[model samples]
Target: MSRIIRNLVSLALLLTAMSVQAAPSSFDLVGPRLSVAVTRDGSTLPLEWVPNLAEGDRVAIKLDLPAGQSDRFRLVAAFLRGAVDRPPDAWFHDTVSGKTKGGDLSLVVPKGAQQLVLFVLPERGAGRNAIVSAVRKQPGTFVRAVQDLNQAALDRARLDTFLDLLFRIGRQDPDSVNAASQVLTRSLAIKLKTECLQQPPELQAACLTGDRETLLFADTHSSALADTLTGAPVDLAFQLSATPQGGYGSYSSYIGVVRDILRLFGAFQSSQLRFVPALARMGDGRLTLLLNTPLSFAKPASVMVVGLPAIEAAKPPPLQAAAGVPLLCAAPDTVLPVEGAPLVYATRYAHDMVLRVAPDGAAGFDLPVHADARRGGFVLDRALPDRSAGATIDARIAGRWGFTPFDGPRFKLSDPRVNRWTAAPRASLVVGRSNAVTLTGEGAGCIDGITMQRGDAAAQAVSWKQDDANTIVVDVPLDKATPGTVTLTVTARAPAPPVSIVLPALQEVGRIDGVAYAAGDESAVLTGSRLDQVREVRAGKATWRPGALTRAAGADRLTLLPVDPAAAQVLTAGERIVADVTF
Candidate 1:
């Protein structure tokens, strides 16, 4: 009996081990409890608990199994809509529809399924220990499913009918018809063409009429056709009539009637539909009727029936005679004359006006007044006047009537002529037999004294003595003047061009006073007479240098020093320092 008990206990233990190794049996799973937690290592697993699911909800199942070697075990998480009793080891495996995480498995609960059963297991001849979990449907999924059903139903027959009407209207014009037909054919080829039979009859009729009632349906239902017909009802209608005729009137009459209908319909339609505004003019007067809306959508058939009224011309302002100005005889009446004044009168007839200026000192057909004159009479209806100064005459009067003062005679100033200079060149002089300087205008003039400092001064100033009317002569002396630069300035109303003088270099005769000596010598005295020939001492010598010496007696003596004993000496003690200098 003890042996028998041992056998039974061992058997029970074996059964318990088998139960632990077995996968859970197929069971119904739903949402709200279904969830996946992704780990930092990119491994994902479904929750341990099953969820309450609704129809159309998705469930993601994951299994945490080793990668690469995972293919050795074919694992699947199967969800059945109904309950089933099956062995855990006998669970079936299904190929996952998407990416798997280490033998992961997922299954969606179908819309028609009332319950779901999930199985996690390996394929035939596979290893074990692959854990699978899944997500289940929730209330939000059911709500979305209902919404989708309603939207699908909403996108039906009515929309198709509206698009059909649009297609019909876009076929009237040859070019538009061809273009739309091509598009339709291409769409049909692509299997994207919509069927008119799917649309409701009421929406179809509204689309045919191009009525506003169909707009909302068109917008939501047929984006392309809706965009085409946004503002283009007239054109759309014409296109529809041009299509192969089966319904409505004959082709020619159909066109005429549609044209007439468009015209009549346009009257009620907003101005925004018409492309061009109406314009009218009478006798050069312009009338513009500004339509407030842009007509990018529709174009009118013709402007003749629109009937734009011609605009009347604006009347010109009434003519007012200038104060104290004469009013010459006008065509219809005799006007009184204002003494010592010019007259101007303005009149208007219809779109035309005339401005009349009476003859003051001259008579002419037409003349323009000076633009600068504030009070002059102007003929706005005629050409501008000549600005040149001249005598004006009325030939009928046989005498010159208008004369511009200072027009023909010459005037002279009583002041003496003065020469002006500005920015004159160095060594320039205004007086002393220089070139004649022309004076521009009459003004008080001043003369600036000549300045001398530069070596090029050869010009000198002398007294200005007037000789005759518009003529003056100035005597200048350049002899005995320092050979340097000088400038003369004269101020007057207007200046003449400047005169410049360049002096030749003067050859100076200079004297030297010594024979060459060592450069270190402090002083070497020299005696010489006739040293006035020296323009500079110790010039043109290689090393002889002149030095200041304090002389107690006789002529002031010049000491000399030499840079080297080889330098030439032209003077000796007691000999005159005779130096020929060219000045």
Candidate 2:
């Protein structure tokens, strides 16, 4: 053979080998059928029907090898404790040499092992280190393989149940169809549009069977659905209409239509069911986890957020999962009762929602939170100091299928700091009207105390609400006020001095007695008692404020522009437009 021919042959062989390696693994072809059985109350029973197993349970691994492949292959079992990167030998592992066809191998589940991974490799290089190294090199591959297997197994059970219901309906059982209706409604976490449900009783069913089915089903090729399913949950802005269609005709046909629709939904579920986690910063500075999962058909009964530290990084500061506490700033009084770190939330059938966690003050955690393989539980982390800043923490999201490493958002260790408060009084004290006062500054949303008083008398009644991040609106009722100077004081989240504003007697406040406007003129004149106190005036829908003021004989005069000309025209049309005068 010539040298050139040999080189060509070698290049062809190299490409073939590369292609083989790059080809994706088919979960079915690499067949080593396995089943788990747990020992409960001294009786070892097969758990083929069980969807999940808890940590620290003693289990037997039943394996069945592929045809003509046995003695050369060995099964390596990795009981995963947490979604953290570790050395090949750092994780717990057990092996069963494929000496015989396939037999039961017994092993105890380690504490905190959220999942178990099995690798069937050739015995020659299948040492513990080699197997772990191969598993670690492609962690996502190993995890996803098991995750897919679990999801498929779950889907199989669901398919069987659905098929059984369909078979009963075929047997002329009308009640079976009604029973399946509830199941079909819960098949997807996404909600139907309000319009679809708002139809009259007779048209309700027709509405769902109409072209409006897209309101509930998103388009299979929609980029929005693809994007939403790929990453953390985002605020869905577009309408959903993918993948499922509304079935027309008889009510029984609707059942078959839903069955087909659910089939498509299941395929979507299999493709997009990612158990990864994403972090979001809530409005009030609280960090939240948005786990990307909850299959359209099989939503999780509960979710857990596990905090794990980096293997090589500095020791993580103490942290806590504030379970059952409401993030007042972000969600206000919505009490989210979570378990602990991994903070477990009993969220059944929730496709995506914000989960808030806080550190526990009492019985805090330590570094290196892990799922214990032997002890059968988790070792959580501790709470950081109140002033701790720039501290980093790692997190993972765990569901029924499995857990995945998640990158959490950076958060501050303390509440928002307020430097000062500035008050912009929007209204004056009128004897029989409500006054609005606007306060703007840092920590404006944290107003807990506010009061109004006349001289040194008792505090007057006032109500205030945070309008935004740096603004607050306070309503002061002057229905029972006597003529006197009223002082307003506000206390907020910050420990600074209380901000105060003073107002003159209610009788001294200005009033708009009459508003004068000329046809086609841009400005309007207001004549009223104490006109100097009047800051703004409204004629119909148009707002007019004094720009230049002049005092005439026994009267105060001001030039004001009608900001809206169209509304000013309504005034010229003799519309009974009310004049609103405010300080």
Candidate 3:
């Protein structure tokens, strides 16, 4: 096994040496493989995707199998495009029976092997397994592009977020920031009394439930009692605040209240730090998540933050986001400031954009943000005015921002407000015939590509035109949908080198095509073209879902029985593989 893995790794290195950040020399990468061919004899199972090997060089093989099904098959790589004899299984499995699923596996290609295959029937009962999907990860045209697109959305988000934080922080209005220290403390102390109590108290059960002010006092310094938070009651958590030896005096005073903030919610900073739930409020228009990590004399950084509220808030706002339920105001006009002596803020990405807000209140973003500036950072009308104490920065930025793809093209897609990188930016779709939708990104030329689908049917790009430099309108022919699968498109020559766009799944509201059984002993080929096997052929149609059937549902033939004799009569047939619904 070690030798086999080593040989595969060596092959990848060899390919890299021959090419620049790309796939192997002789092979080409193929798209996803959801279909499988299981020979009647079960001697071999060939994937829809064969390793690309029109050969200019040598090759090896890699395979990924469905869970708990690896033992049912053995790996074999083909050579000479079948001109020469194929090699044996590259490595031997401990299980003589290929029935259990193993993770991804690789094999050594023969000196002349160009493609890969699997011998499925190691044993008689082994025909019950399959491969979910496989790609040789070739070094070709789209490899780098796809990798870039993957990170593009993420990069855009960080950059936009960084800009949003910078611009919003510049507008900070400290005067509007009312000090809630006393109010927060009293509220925390009262809330704590209602939800919690001290263990081994000198008083009886209801003793400390009402007089929350005293309970707050008793619990605050309960170092004798404040030892462990392991006593959180159901739906309630335990929190305590302790003042370090040298700390902010008033800030130290409310340490207990702030401690609750540290406990209930996550920190405003990096994922590395953790914070508990702290309650701030949705004051009229502003929705805030407030937690003040006390800045000492040494680290005297103090600034308030206004974050997008939780997806679902405890109470509704006057202006609800989606439903009547109140949501975090779309984009709070507040920028995030680095929490240190010298404030630093940058896009979430490692690179792209960075802004330095000097403590003296001067702020500068990496690029001049002009509203109509194409290919520039988040657009602003004019260069920002330097801000000072309590500046009220309303960074009203919007949409899914992303970075540029690597080594691909000069084109970039940002400002999700108008052109988002997501598949379903519209958030809704209708199925039956075809549906038209727009894709947002930055590219040089007219869009010449699209990918779409509804239910079992796939969609094709019927017509497309460049809406502008940043937007392209593409029409897709959608099929009648039950639940539309995610539709993706690879638009060639958008900004030039061609880019792929994955729209959100066009969620279709339609009927379910469940596999219902007829009464009696029966064996029939399932309706679909390429199905291997299904775990349960619905015994009775009792609220079944697609998930009820596992991935190995590639087998064409299925055998089923009725859950009840009455249901048997309702279904009447042995195997109703095909549906009788009107199209």
Error of 1 at 575 (Å): 99
Residue 279 deviation, candidate 1, in Å?
Answer: 89
| Alpha carbon lDDT of each predicted model | 0.28, 0.41, 0.28
lDDT of 2 by residue, 1-583 (tens): 6999999999999999998765422112112345555564464434431224555456676545556764544455676544454423545455554554444567666555566654444455335565565556555444433443333322222222333433444356443343332333223212233453454444443443333222222222333543344322222211211211111000110112222222332332222121221111111112122222331222311111111111111111112333322222211231222211111111111111222234434332222333221121223333333442221122222222111112222122212233246665644565544567676665553356788887778986588876655566778777566777778887654444577778765665455557777777878888755665677887657888776766556355767776676777666645466777787
lDDT digits (tens) for residues 493-560 of candidate 1:
22222333333323233334443333334444454432322233342443344556433342336555
Q: Please provide, for model 3 over 428-452, each residue's C-alpha lDDT reduced to its tens digit, 9 standing for 90 to 100.
A: 5444434456665543132345555
Number of the top candidate by lDDT? Answer: 2
* Alpha-carbon TM-score of each model against the true structure: 0.13, 0.32, 0.20
Off by over 4 Å in 3: 1-191, 195-241, 245-363, 366-418, 421-583
